[model samples]
Each structure stands twice: as structure tokens, then as C-alpha cells.
Target: MRVRRKPNPNRNHPLHCPYCASELLFPDEETEFAWSCQDCLRVFSVQFHGQDDPPVKPEPARSSHEALANSLKRKGHEL
Candidate 1:
């Protein structure tokens, strides 16, 4: 008997051609990991190396006045 596996809903699929950067239409999967790009006519494979390090926390947004002051400082101007 053939065992059926449920499809993952959260899985992300490649949407653009890696070589030409053109939008892919119905990309063909040659194998479990290999994909074919129609525009560039290139076959490539995607693999998961490992989980990446956690993203660095972004700096808090600066107010308009603070932003202007920084811009002036860069231009060698004093507020």
C-alpha cells in the first residue's frame, strides 16, 4: 500500500527564476528538491542548510525632529 503524506500549508515555494529573476509560471519540480526555471532554462536545487541565527532587533524609529537634526549633523551643520 502507498502511504500518502499531507501537504504542508505553511511551506514557501519559489516564485521567481533564480537566474533571470523572471516570474515563474508553474515551475516544474524535476525532483523533490530540484526545480526548473522556464525563462533562463536552468535547473537548480534548493536545500535547507539549517536554521539561521535570530534576527537582530531593529532600532526604534526616530522622530521627525531627531531625523532632521541627524541629517544636519552629517552635513556639518549645527542645530
Candidate 2:
């Protein structure tokens, strides 16, 4: 018996190339997780190391002491 599978819609979520955002990315059938960009001509592979999350940006430190001093100076109470 021949079984026909349904086509996936969300499979092409990230269809653009990283190097060139305007380029279309094509997956290599011979290699798993391998992708190529038509415009940039870049051949790369995708892999998930379980948790390959994006880097987090550090928050700027609050200057409470300087702010307090500035407020005091504005009220003519220089310290």
C-alpha cells in the first residue's frame, strides 16, 4: 500500500538566508539539516545542541547614588 503524507506549512518558517535576508534558502536532500542560500551561494547546516539559545543582553546598571546627588544639588543642597 502506498501512503501519501500531508505537506507541512510551518516547515518553511525560516526560509531566508542569514547572510542575505532577501535570499531564499534551499535544503539539501542528501544531507540532513543542510541549507543553501540561492542569492548568497552559502551552504550551511543547522543543528540543535538541545539548548542553543540566543545570547542575552545585559541590563544597564542604575545610578541611584548619582541621581540622589543630582536631586540634592537641584534643591541647592550640595553635598
Candidate 3:
């Protein structure tokens, strides 16, 4: 018998266009990454990491995870 592992819970959060404030619909296409602000129509790119990269933008004081990730990436661990 085989057991299946559960996926990350956070990945379940739906992506939304920051500009239009509409739910971003992902197409059935295989792509590396994509981004677009729905409200401002600002397009951007996204890179995935285990628990880093999306540095907690607001609170600079309590950003240990972000700092650790950045440090790891700098050390060439792929963050």
C-alpha cells in the first residue's frame, strides 16, 4: 500500500488580481510563473520557495523567516 502526502495548506489560497480585485483565473497551461495586479493592472513575476521569498513586507522588525531565506539564497541554497 502507498500513502499520499497532503499538500501545503497555504497554497490553497486563491490568487487575486491586485488591480481589478477580481479572482485571477489560472488557465490549464503549464507555465513557470505569472503575476498581475487586478486593481492596478500591475504585472509581475513570482518565484516559489518552501517558506521564503515572500518576505513579510510590512513588519520589518519581525522578519526572521525572510531574513533566513535571503541568507540561505545568498549562500546558494536556492532558498
Candidate 4:
């Protein structure tokens, strides 16, 4: 009997840019938990608090422009 191994979620790569909604290509500039988007030229990171942790509530954005600005600001980029 052969035992099948479950796929690892950590091996998955992001398919799109969370900031610009652009499709990401192979060999994207990557770090341990962050990825850089070439289209928006922004760096984004995702943190998993684990299944035991409660979901986080994101801050409300007044508009798309404000959201972009806030995202960039969080990434230490000046717009």
C-alpha cells in the first residue's frame, strides 16, 4: 500500500499582486514572507497568525487612492 503525502501550503506561491491586482510571473522578487510586485513596484507581505488565532480586521480605507497610499506607506515607500 502506498501512502499519499499531503501537499504543503507553504510551497504555494502568490498568483497575483495584492496591491495592484496584477498577475505575478515566475521568479518574482521574494523574501521569507514578502513579495515584490513589478507592475506596481510595491513590496507586500502576508503574515499567518495560525488557525488558533482570530481573524484580523483591516483598517477601513476611504478610497482606492487612500488604500494605495496606506499600503505604500506601510511598506516604507514614499508616494
Best by TM-score: 1
Please provide, for model 2 over 1-79, each residue's C-alpha lDDT reduced to its tens digit, 9 standing for 90 to 100: 9775554433343556777785587875545566788787877766554655469866766599988998898999979
* Cα RMSD of predicted structure 1: 7.5
Residue 22 Cα positional deviation in candidate 2, in Å, after optimal superposition:
2.9
Lowest-scoring 10 consecutive residues by lDDT in candidate 1? 4-13
Using TM-score, rank the candidates from best to worst.
Answer: 1, 2, 4, 3
lDDT of 1 by residue, 1-79 (tens): 9776555443346777678887663434465566677777887766565787669967889999999999999999999
lDDT of 4 by residue, 1-79 (tens): 9886564455446788877788763333365566677788887766565565448867665798988999999999999
- lDDT (Cα, tens digit) per residue for candidate 3, span 1-79: 8776454343333376545667764422133344544456555444455665565566556378988988898999984
lDDT of 4 at 18: 75
Task: Work out the TM-score per prediction.
Answer: 0.43, 0.41, 0.26, 0.40
What are the per-model numbers of colliding residue pairs? 0, 0, 9, 0
Ranking by lDDT: 1, 4, 2, 3
Clashing pairs in 2: none
